[model samples]
Target chain A: MPKTIEEINAKIKAGKAVVVNAEEVIGIVREKGIARSAVDIDVVTTGTFAPMCSSGIYFNIGHSKPRIKLEAARTYLNDVPAYSGFAAIDIMLGATALPESDPRNKIHPGDFNYGGGHVIEELVSGKDVCLSAATYGTDCYPRKKLETWINIRDLNDAVLYNFRNAYQNYNVAVNVSDKTIYTYLGILKPRMGNAVYCCAGQLSPLLNDPWYKTIGIGTRVFLGGGSGYIAWPGTQFNPSVPRTEAGIPKRGAATLSLIGDLKNMQPRWLRGVSMQGYGVSLSVGVGIPIPVLNEEILAHTAVTDDDIPATIIDYSRDYPQNLPDVLGEVTYAQLRSGRIRFNNRDIPTASLSSYSRALEIANILKEWMNQGAFLLSQPVTPLPGIESGLAFKPLNYRPVERNNSS
Target chain B: MKVSRKIVLHFPARLVEEAIAYRLVKEYNLQFNILKASIIPDSEGFIVLELTGEQEDYDRGVRFLTKIGVNIEALSQNVVRNEDKCTHCGACLTVCPTGAFEIEPGTRRVLFMHDRCIACSMCLKACPPRAMELHF
Candidate 1:
């Protein structure tokens, strides 16, 4: 029997079963979407059937020895993981075996109608059920399928309930679409603190993949508009920091020293010609994940507005009980020493000399994001380096005049 | 280095006499020549064209055909598999052009050996149960 929801909750609370977090939910949803979409696209573009046989035949002789064999050979040319797994014949015999019937007796070659009209039914129902259960069980909780199922069910229930509360509080319809979430927040519920907090925990599978590595940095940066801003890259850094300098502040770099060092860090990927002008900065002394950590700091700073200077100070000092308070102290000391500012506002303006360099940087960053950071250390013989080199020419970026309407 | 090129055209048999094939030859300004133009029966209606020209010109001819909305696909000589609903009765043994299918001894099961299949499709037309197919 399946365990009750209450029992599952108790197990979770007791730490006997792991609870599914927002990140895991988001990852699962993303992977499912990707797999389904890829399957559809491959079918449409290639016009190829999935390798698994859709039809099978089974012949049975009533009451005597029943023999079952698949009509078609199972082929694995299509690379479908679902069809390649184990399958079995679940035979349901209608009547009892006759005493005169011999189990090993083969039906005569010309006998079409014999043995009290036997019925043969082929079963295909368990294919999808078994495949789905196995994939989910192994991927999420290799050791415990029931525990993972319970945790995911609980998490999904919580998210749905939270979304419902958001809908009621914001005066929006229950069917509000995800595409409209950002717009809704911006217009109808910009100041709703609970709505924002609720959304932060809602795992969007369409937006996140589990296999995709993500680094959440919680750090403070100056937005330069008198308000601080938070930037969450969602995934890990495109260009990961080198391992040697990972978590260590560069010597004598005062402004960044306040930010905790990210030891053994690496950029997520390399940039190509298409993307330019995107890099992240981190303080040497903080222990936050570079992506979300930086964003959280920005969020806190943005709330304070221009009253606060663009300093790398301990934003969590007031809430001394906060876990990040220890790192906040180091950040504050670095800010006092003028080691880190809120914004790196030194981006060069568009000009002949700077345009090319900016474009080059943008391309490098773009390639990095698309290809991932794992390929960063590989030889870049086919592509040009981020800096100017012997083979490739520097990229050019010139601003075009905008169309002015009457 | 120079390389010779050839283009294989596929179309409905009824359209073989049309001016499209001749016009393609003149447009490329090539030493165009048709090797064999034939119609495949029972394919609804389709034609095949084999042309020889310079590699560059052959590529240009393909693009021209594509622009004119001609359905062109690479022609590969392979066994084609066709399936029709079968009633489990073996009756095509007599008319089979190739002895590709035979009944298993004592089991009455029909077995197909693809190697002996000539893709003649005679069994496809002969089978009363309509289970035989030409697979490529």
Candidate 2:
């Protein structure tokens, strides 16, 4: 029977509905095609657990005794800069933020043991971390300095409000330089020695909903072992990135801004990562359920790793800005198979992302849906499409003057 | 019987000129795959090798090396890395399920905890320098 949104919600509320993951949706499509799969399956859960560098956590630490207006305050959570630009106790800690203890990437090559992500992980694991802050004392508010230990419980409100979480697609990283490079890409061997990529391809939420028709504000998602929502379009959400005929991005494209409760998170999915020369980052595990409302939705949900091809780039060069030429394209299946052959050259592929954890999160979301603890939400507004291009703002006097007038 | 073991064969400066591997194969009917070797003349030399042979022949080869004062020792780790070659790129961190490969903070160096490793062998090929090796 073709199920309506209301009908599906009713079944879910009553504890009766059949939910298949993105991986399972393919077999259903092959057997019954998109038409029947849409009617039969209530929901198609998609998951991706990758090391998302453009991430952070926001915290409302409540009023301290004597409540100082801490405008110039400098805050550090376990030595990681948790700089909150706001007037009071709200603080934001970026995932890639490194501790001030390290002067530079000077520790040793590639052994960055701790950073903001590690602090977040430790807090999520119920471990206490030192919280210290200093600010000039005001006439009314006397306290100038504060130092204490805090865990997830001490905060009045601790939310993982990541400005960027799930990337729709990402590039494979390789080194073409003379020396091996340590990057957030997890150490690139020069001369394209080893290739590493992160993403679950077809199983990713944005891929299944390529146009972001079902992923937007209020679209409930499973984030790092907890429920979250797509708060806004992520930073560098270039829907304008060139795409293949299959609608997959030829380069990096759409991304999402996610928000979830830090208290509800688990340490297993929120892992701390460090690159030798690079700083630290958090590996966030996210699972989003895509409801199969029609044949289009079902068809996209059935997309496989082989069907999606993301680009491989040379990380040895200055990236995102001064990016080098694209090496070539390869499918997720080929990359995940531990080897990829492109441009007549055989390259071994490694992933900073975890496919196992992605699967585990998908299963958890499926169970959450089954138990009626979670519900799929229709997007209030669909995101921009391929026609919407993104361009850099040129720092020219005339062009800038023109923009300022407008 | 076929056997594979990582044994370090040490040679004094005087024995550096000798063809020890050729002699072992010819005398004991054993096979050797040299994993690492640096036999500099007039200096203490060592060769890390995987020697495979019949049970009796393997025992006899060990005795022969000992008699020649070529110190032979076994490795506790099957999957070992050459520190000189390890650039600590952290490529192995992606495949490790047990969190065995850790990057120390402040220094940003890769720390390997052999106990937590499940021996998936994913790092063997992912490593760029070929620093990672598996004896077993």
What TM-score should be assigned to candidate 1?
A: 0.16
* lDDT of model 2 at position A150: 79
Worst 10 residues of 1 chain A by lDDT: A160-169
Q: Which numbered prediction scores highest in DockQ against the true structure?
A: 2
- Interface RMSD, every prediction, one decimal place: 35.4, 10.4
lDDT of 2 by residue, A21-103 (tens): 88878888999977777778888888887678888888777777877645678888988888877868788888878777766
lDDT of 2 at A208: 84
Off by over 4 Å in 1: A1-406, B1-46, B49-58, B67-69, B73-136
- Estimate, for each residue in A244-264, the C-alpha lDDT of model 1 and write its tens digit: 111211110111111111112
The runs of at least 3 residues in candidate 2 whose Cα sits more than 4 Å from the true structure, single-residue gaps closed, are: A1-3, A107-110, A318-321, A387-406, B1-6, B12-45, B49-63, B72-90, B93-136
| Consecutive 10-residue window with the lowest summed lDDT within model 2 chain A | A391-400
Per-prediction DockQ scores?
A: 0.01, 0.14
lDDT of 1 by residue, B1-136 (tens): 2233333566554554557766667886545434334554534233344455676876787788777656675434334333323322233333344556554543333456665554456555333222455543
